[model samples]
Target chain A: MLKDITLGQYYRADSVIHRLDPRTKIVGTLVYMISLFLFNNLICYVFAAVFLTFVVGLSKIPPKFMFRGMRSVLFLLVFTVIYNIFLSTGTVIVKFWVFTITYEGIQQAVCMLIRLFLLIVGSSLMTLTTTPNQLTDGLESLFKPLKIFKVPVHEMAMMMSIALRFIPILMEETDRIMKAQIARGADLENRNIFIRVKSLIPILVPLFVSAFRRAGDLALAMEARCYHGGEGRTRMKAMSFSAGDIVAWVILAGYIFAVVFLGVTFKTFPEFLVLEMKAGLEYLIPTLSAR
Target chain B: MDIEVRNLTYEYDSGTPQAVRAVDDVSLTIPGGQFVGIVGHTGSGKSTLVQLIDGLLKPTAGSVYLDGEDIASRKFDRKHMRSLIGIVFQYPEYQLFETTILKDVCFGPLNMGLKQEEAVNAATDALLRLGIPRESFGASPFEISGGQKRRVAIAGVLAMNPKILILDEPTAGLDPGGREEVLGLLKSLNESGLTIILVSHSMEDVAKYVDRILVMNEGKIFMDGNGKEVFSHVEQLEEIGLAAPEVAYLMKAVHDAGIPVATNITTAEEACGEILRALKN
Candidate 1:
């Protein structure tokens, strides 16, 4: 049951997005995320959503698969939405109990949820399309200039790739240990909060020990093969910018341009759509409350 | 405590593009008190099959019946049934986490809702039966040798008082002596009427112990019979990347060398007796 983690996992496919240079995908994710925070209005999100949908379609990964990845961050999404709705001060739309629901608060909540959703899914898309090795190669290339300042870019990239590789392995180990304990009558599904928390001790302790043992074995194996840092290492599959990468960059630039243009041209949505939405909500809320 | 698997199938990562049919449609019935060994190449679904039987995994397209009741049915007490079937996973020694060996062994009985005193007694009995010395029970599990730690892990499951014990590669990383110790212990456990389903990659190990053998290939039970029946088809077993026990090959060599001995000898001891008789003749 623990195998549902999709974040940081690459989905193999022969698609335009998957074929793009990892550097292009990484930079595109960063720029796209920055664009989400660049504008405060819903019109920008319309463009953002269209772009994400187009990229998601081009990536060839199943929409269901992408949404499944969102399950891990669902709690954070709900928490942030609730936090914005109750905490922000504005013209109060409804006041009940100790809580005040403001028009501006609801607006902020919607915007925040959309922003967080787009940000997470956008970044996750990048990882989903790119292998961990490709990601490390991209990071190493991007950080190559940092080496001029005495930074260990290669070492950091190597460590990151190793860590990413271990994630699935460790998850598999955790699942095995959990089943073993369960077979021995470990009651992981106890309703009591304290007992449930305490039940994790069996899983966590064994997972940690096995992880450390694996790490030690890996280190020894690497040393035996004379893996003495990335200084003199040569790449077997060197990263190169293909024609698809250029097309990706151009699409990203166009997306940024469109978002900025919309943000400048319309502070919020166009007047008519907003009025129509408000009218629609005015007619919708009361019948629901009457029921 | 008999297991009846009816058209059982399992898929890993179901509903995903990467879904793999780990266990295809399989039907087998293992009676109570049977010593069965499941042999397959790696990824042939031996482990998955055992887990499905243990109810650790829900089958995608079939049902497992424990004592004539569908284990996956809602009304069935699956948790209680699970407690009756102990599964010692591969590298079970990694499951030990308690401060002391005795406490670790006590985890199983305690989780089964046994009283503290009763749990301690069961744990002590299991440990002693597994050949763990008394003084070592108070020591940290980490301080024990690898084989002892594995035995303690097995003892932990034994403490739960399971009627059926399913072990997946229980002797995987042990020395030859340790492997013999574990297999011998399992043999005696089977003698005591506990159904033991041993999943192993070693043909020699399975042939030496289990009364019945199931040869799995590509998620299907390719062969099912006693050792003599299964090992007799040495050519077919080799086609699926498996083999008869090494002694069977030795016997085959002996038979091919003009001796009138049978080539179906599975164990070294049996091969010895047959060879001595043939030489005397």
Candidate 2:
């Protein structure tokens, strides 16, 4: 029944993004997110939206799936929008009850919402396209320079991989425990907040007990197989910088260069681009909706 | 405690790309106080059928009638129905979380609104029914042997005092001796007038105990009959990824080798007796 949770948001499909080297995707996502924060006005925001949509389309992951990750942070987005809309000062659009909505407030809210939406979608695409194992591998390679500072980077990656693996197992365990209690007539639904929290004790106790047991078993199994620390460990599949990865880096660099250039151009010629974007949107939105 | 299922079907993820017709158009009657066995290959809708029977899952279509009353109706007392028809899932032993064996067994009865003393009494009675020793009543369920923990788990359900007992693989993971012990208790319980629905993958266990057998295949009841009648159709059962009891196959092999013996034997005891008689002749 709890299967509706599409968390970890891994969209499974055959696409260029899915096949891209995890390092490239990771760095690409970082550049994408950094540019999202760098964009200052409507013109750049529109370009950013276009860029994100293009990447999402190329990834072949459903738009629904990419936005599904946004569902978890929807409240934060709304709160930020409301906070910025009501609290910020500019040419007032309306005034009511110690609150004022300004034209600037509307612009900030829209820009913030778009940024939040793009942030979630961009990150979700990376996770959805790259498997957890690949993510761990990418992180390990990216943090390799820290190994000189005595960081157990390999060990950290292994821990992450194990944690990622246990997520599904723990989810199944939780479902079973919840059902077992429910079958015994433990009412999980229709409880007040306090009682609901208390009702979870039955689930928590068994879950903790099982988790400990599993961890202990895993440790023993690892020891029995003569596993030590990650000091001299070697990977079965070593990471390589492929042609696809180079293409991804080049595209990402171009995107950052465009955003930086756009930011400078916006600083120098704000009125020209802003007026043109306003007119384009005013023309485009109605036609899009009519279609 | 008669259960009549009428054209029941359950679909998981209905209308999705991965939609599954788990139990499709299945209808059957479980007579009062009878030991019936449900057998099928994994994912053959055996578990789905039992879960539907207990109202744990609502059917996508059709109804389940208990004593001619439709249990699936919106107004049915779901809690009372669950109390009346207890379901012990596979590996129920893993569900034990109470501090003591007695406490663990009492959970169900207490949940049904019994007083503390009454719940304990019900739990004790159930434990005794399964031959669990009273000396171990106060012991932690975690401290018990694997087989004992399973008994304690079953006792927890039996404490509810259900008229119909539904077990999915009650003897699963038990040693041969533990399996026989569990089956013996089920037999006695059936004799004492509890309608028992046993879902199992072990055809030998089913043949040894259950009077009637239901074979599920591709989300439907492919075969329904007494042990003899159902086991006789070996080919049909095999086609659906099931086989008759080894004893029945032994008898069939002997019969096919030109020996004059009954081919429908479903128990080792009966098959041995027939083979001995054939040897003597």
Candidate 3:
């Protein structure tokens, strides 16, 4: 049951998306998030959707698997849509005793839901295709420019990579400790919720203690290896941007431009113009009817 | 409580691309009141087999019968089953978090649904039996020595009043004196009619304490018999990266040196006596 959790899960596949430099993927994800918010029209949404679909297909990552990432934040997405529909005010389409449902409210709610869903899917695409080590390496290299500010960029990347490496180890340890407690007749499941929460104290305290102990040991080991930040440290595998990376960047940039252009020209400007024309027509229609 | 594993098979990461068969189809009977020692190198399925018996792991196929009842049956109470078969995992002392030794020991019986008074009584009795002082019961478990901490952990399991007890590498990382003390405690527990299953790397301890030895290799049972019978196949044991009991090795060496000594000797005391008799002759 614990194994099904896909937080920081990476799917191994030999595809162009998987082969792109981790640095490229990270930057691409940031740009994709920006483009998702830039699109306000249905046409722009369609363009973004089709682009994501093509990337997902090229990555060979199943669409069903990508959707699984949405399951965790599914409740939040629902909450956002429901709140937007009820609270947003515009031209009322349906009116009750005190509440009004507007046409624009429905539109805003749908757009908000789509935006949140796309954000999760796009970020998940980055994590699914990149290994934790590679991601950290990319972050360190990207942050190399911050050396001017002395931000300890390399140390931060090293720490992240180490944390990722120890996740499985800690998981296995937790499993063992949980079983040990169970053997001692600790009924973690059968107790009342309050008692269950209290019982976790026993498990959590030891887990934290051991984690700190491991961290201390790891620090000492790293020190013994003469690890003094990333200064003068040469990497075993050099990061190189290949032809696939360049093509990926080009396609992503083109897709973002199209989404932004369509959103502005078709959705925002047309909606503004239509509202203005509606006001003018309202006055003309009343006069014509009077005549 | 006897544990009967019938056609038991387990696969790690089942249904995943990285799936591996850790425990292949196997059948074994661990009779009530018998002390069985399981020995294997790392990744030999010995640990997996023990976890199956204790129900820490559910087999992918087949069933585990505890005293003629299928443990995997929906009607079975898992907590009750676990209480009945107490398991002391390797280096289990690391799990100790209770403020006092008594409270830590009482944790198990309380989980078994005993009243606070009854749990305290059981914990007291267990600590006393394990040679911990009544005064030490009130002290923090963390304040004790490593050996004392280990005994406290074992006493924690003992407090549950299990009919069958399983220990994984109980003697690991212990000094010779501490090892003997812990093994002796287990031997006494076995003598009192509690079925014991011990998984360990120390062939000497197993030969000295257990009635039978099970040799595991590559997720399959390689051999299962009385200590003398299992240790007699010196060549096979060594082939699988396991050494026979030192007494058995000494006996075999003496026999091969043209002495008429028996090669199946398992205990050090018996080997000493036999060597004395051979010298006199």
Candidate 4:
């Protein structure tokens, strides 16, 4: 059951999406996400959906494998759908004793639902195609300006990569420890919520101890290898952008422009999209989008 | 209790590209109150086989009858299987979390719903049976030597009074003296009527101690026999990245040198007796 978690999982395949530079993929994902919120009509959604599906096909990752991650976010998806269903206001399409369903409310719900789904899937595409090391390298390079302010960017990036490397190792360790406790008759399953939490103390206490021990051993191993806070470290595999990445960026820029253009021309764009864009941008930047 | 495995098969991460048949169509039996040892090279399914017997893993397509109860069946009581068959995994001491050795040892029996005093008595009895001193009972398990901590971990499982005990490389990290101490403890316990399943890579230890041996290779039972009989087929054993016991090799060397000694002697004492008898003749 622990193996079912697909967080930060990368699927390795030979495809245009996987072969593109990590920076290009990261930037392209950002542009694609921004384009998702710049639309409010069925035509714009159709264009977005087609673009996404095309990219998914190009990536060569199985659709079933890609969407398997949505299981974890099902709760959030349902919550947002319900929230938009009753709260969004407009012409009342149906009226019950205490509840009213509006045409605009249904439209808003569909838009919000599409946006949320696209947002998760779009970002997951980046992680699925790129390795954690490549992702870290891209992020560190993007955040290189922070080094000018002496923010220790290199050390932070190194720590993150090491943490990612050990996640599977720690997960396997937890599985073993849980099995050991179970052989001792520790009931991790079949308990009430309160008792279950209490029962986890046996599992958690040892897990914490072993984790600390592993951390200590890792620190010692690093010191033995003369690791000194990422100073003067050079990557063996250097990062460089190629022509394929340029083509990808060009397509993304065109896609963003088309979404913005079609979004504005859709009837009801003035009333519905203005409010949605405002809400979306406010989420991106609290201060800048307050207006 | 007896364990009867019939056509047992297990696969890790089945249906994916990474799927592995760690144990395949393997059938065997561990009769009650027997000292049995399983020998295999790395990835030979030795570890996976033991876990399957105790219900830690369910077989994909087979049955495990633990004393006439189908342990793989849906109605089988999993918790009862756990208590019936205790497993001390490799480096078992790493799971120790209690402050004192006594509490750590009592953890298993307490988990089985024994009263506090009864659990304490059972734990103390287990520690005594393993020859752990009373003075060390109150000490922290972390404060002891690596060997002592391993014994404490084993004692924790023994406190449950399991009908069958399966240990996976119980002496893996210990020194030679500690290894003998641990093995000696296991030998005496086996003699005193606790069914023991010893899993190890050390052919020397298994040859010297266990009366019955099961050799595994690539997820299948390659050979099974008495220690003397299994160790006699040195070449076949070596073909699969395993070797006969050191004594058998020693006797073989003497025989090749025309000393006319039997090369099938697996234990040191048996080799010594055969060598002495040959010299007298």
Candidate 5:
């Protein structure tokens, strides 16, 4: 059951996005995240959504899986929408005894929800197409100039890649330890909250012990093989930007331009415009509540 | 506790492109109270097959029957099944993390819902059976010797009072003396009516202790018989990357050298008796 965890899981596939330089994908993802918060209008959101859909298609990752990823954060999305709807101050659309739903509140809630969903989907696409090794290589290359400031870029990338590689191995160890505990009659299921928390001790303790043991063994093995802090080291597969990477950059630039143009031209949505016009008519007509 | 596997098949990473068929259309009935040894090269499905018997794995196809009840059935409680069949995994010392040897050994019984006092008593009895000192019960397990730690880990499983004990390479990485100690404990457990299924690459250990041997190759059982019968087919066994028991090989050489000694020898003592008889003739 633990195997279903797909956080930062890379699925290998031969596609345009998968073929793009890892450096390009990494930089593009950063740019996309920055641009998400920059655009606020409905037209810009539409443009962003379309651009994400096109990229998702090119990556050959099923839309269903992307939606599945979003499902994990669905609870937070609903909570945000509900909180904004009742708590924000604006012209009331619906009035109860003490609670009122406002026009601006609904607009902000929808915009925020869409923004969060797109953020997760866009970043997930980057991870899904790029291997962990390639991603780290990209990070090292991108941050190589920082070495002038003595930032230890190579060491950081090496550590991150090693950590990423061991995640699955550690997860597998955790599963084995849990099974051993279960065999011993530790009931992890159908217990009270306190008991359940206590039950995890058996699994976690062994997991940590084994993790440390593996780390020590790995260090010795690396040292025995003469590994020394990534200095004067060369890679077998060097990173290079291809034609596909350039095309990807061009498309990303076009997406940013479209978002910027739509953000400037579209001041308000038609639905909000209609709501304001209706409120103006309400002011002209006398209401029984006003009496 | 007899384990009856029927047409069992398992696939790793099922539904993914990287899926692999680890176990395929395999079925075997391991009789109750028999010390069965499973031998296979790495990745030949020995580990996967044993895990199936204890319900650590559910077969993609077919089922496992323990004491004639389908273990995969919804009516069957897997946790209770696991308690009935104790599996001491390879490098079991890695599973040790308790503050005291007693607490670590008592883990199984406590999980079985035994009272604290009852669990402690059971752990003590198990430790005594495994030849661990009673005074060492309160000591940290990490401070113990490697062999003692392994015994303590096995005692943790023995504390559950399981009927069938499945050990995966119990003697792996141990010195000869340590290997003998662990194997001797298993031999005593078998004498006390506990069924043992030992998975190992050491043909010598299996020849000395196991009642029956099951040889696996490429995810299928290549041979299943008593030690003598399995070892007698030295050529076939060697073809699958397994060698006959040393006694068996020596006897085969004696027979090939024109001696009328029996080739069905598996243990050194049996081979010695055969050689004496041959000399008398």
Candidate 6:
């Protein structure tokens, strides 16, 4: 069951997005995420959705596979939506039992949910299409200017690549350790949360120990092969911008310009939908009170 | 307890494009007190089949029956399965976590809801049976040798007093002497009427110990028989990138060289006796 995690996992596909430079995808994701928070109107969100769908389509990743990453953030999504719906102050549309639902509150919650959803999907697309090694190479090349300020950009990128590589290894180890503990009759599925957490001690201690051991062995192997940091290191697949990357950047720029332009021109939800929601609530609340 | 798997199929990453049938429509009945060895090349679904039987993985189709009761049925007590069938995964020694060897072994029985004294007694008995000394009981599991750590891990499962034990590559990464010791221990355990299923690639080990051998290839049971019967199809085994024991190959060469010895010898002792009888004739 632990294998269901799709976060930070690369999906292999022969597609335009998969072959694009990792730097382009990474930068495009950042631009898309920033644009998501820059706009709150329904029109901009629709535009962003169109953009996200187009990119995801080009990536050739199955919609189901892409959405599986949403499961991890589902709890946060629900909490944020619920929190926004209750707390945002605005014109009240329905008041029932101490809970007030406002038009503005509904609008804000919808916008936030869309923002979070788009943000997760846009970023996940980057990770899903780009391999870890390519990502590190792209990042190191992108941050090459930081070397002038004495920053260990290459080392940091190497560490990130290693950490990313270890995610699946550690997950498999945790799974094995969990099964071993369960085979020994460890009650990991206890209903009590505290007991469940306590039972995790058996799984965690070994996971951490093995992770450390693996890290040590990896370090020794790297050293044995004369890996003395990323200095003087040459990449087999050098990071170079391609025509597809340029096209990706151009599309990202257009998306950002559209989101910003629309966000500036329209500061709130469209007026007619708000009027219709008020009318609907006005007709519904009195009938409920009459009952 | 005898285990029966009926049309058991498991798919990893099910419902996705990358879904693969790890165990495909396998049906097998393992009677109680049988020493069965499952031999296959890597990625042939041996591990997946064992995990499915252990209930670690829910089959995409079919059911597993323990002593004629469907273990996956809602009314079946899953805890009873956990306490009855023990699984020792490959590199089991890496699962050790407790501060002391005794406490680590005690983790199982205590989890089974045994009282403190009873758990300790079970743990001590298991450790002693695994040939761990009394003085080492209080030592940290990390302080032990690799083989000792493996024994402690096995003791951890044995303390649960499981009737059936499944080991996946129990002798992997061990020296020849340690491999023999572990396999010998398993043989003795099997002789004591505890059902054992060993998953190993070593044909020699399988021929030396197990009564029944199941050869898996690409998620299917390619061959199922006793060692001699399975090894007799040496060409078929080789076609699957597997082989019979080295002695079986040697005996085949001897028979081809016009010796009157049998070509189906699967173990060293059998090969030696067959060769001697041929020479005597």
Supply DockQ values for each candidate: 0.80, 0.57, 0.72, 0.77, 0.62, 0.82
lDDT of 5 at A254: 87
Instruction: For candidate 3, give the docking quality class from DockQ.
Output: medium
lDDT of 5 by residue, A1-291 (tens): 687766688887899999889999999999999898775676777888888998899898876556656666677678667766775667789989888899877876787678778888899899889999999999999999999999999999999999999999998898888777776777789559999998888888888888888999999999999988868999999888888878888988888887788777886675654543344244324433445
Q: Best candidate, DockQ-wise?
A: 6
Tens-digit lDDT track of model 2 for B1-281: 89999999999867545579999898888889999999999999998898888877778999999999898778888788868998898888878888999998988888888999999899999999888998989999898899998998899888899999999999989999999999999999899999999999899999999999998888988888899999999998888888988988888888889999989889988888999999899
Docking category of candidate 1 = high
Score each candidate by Cα lDDT: 0.89, 0.85, 0.85, 0.87, 0.85, 0.89
Which prediction has the highest TM-score against the true structure? 4
Candidate 6: residue A140 Cα off by (Å):
1.7
Q: What is the DockQ of the complex in model 2? A: 0.57
DockQ, structure candidate 1: 0.80
Candidate 3 segments whose C-alpha is farther than 4 A from its true place: A60-65, A89-107, A257-269, A272-291, B234-241, B246-261, B270-281
Chain A TM-scores, candidates in order:
0.86, 0.89, 0.88, 0.91, 0.89, 0.86
Error of 6 at B223 (Å): 0.5
> How close is every model to the real structure, measured as TM-score?
0.90, 0.91, 0.87, 0.93, 0.87, 0.92
Question: Is 1 or 6 the stronger prediction by TM-score?
Answer: 6
Better of 4 and 5 by TM-score: 4
**Which parts of model 2 are misplaced by more than 4 Å?**
A268-291
Point out the worst 10-residue segment of candidate 2 chain A by lDDT. A271-280
Candidate 3 on A126-165: residue-level lDDT in tens?
A: 9999999999999998998998997989889988999999
Query: Model 3: number of clashes?
Result: 0
Q: How well is each residue in B238-271 modelled by candidate 3, as lDDT tens digits?
A: 9999999877878888988988887789998999
lDDT of 1 by residue, A188-219 (tens): 99899999999999999999999999999999
| Regions of model 4 farther than 4 Å from truth | A264-268, A278-291
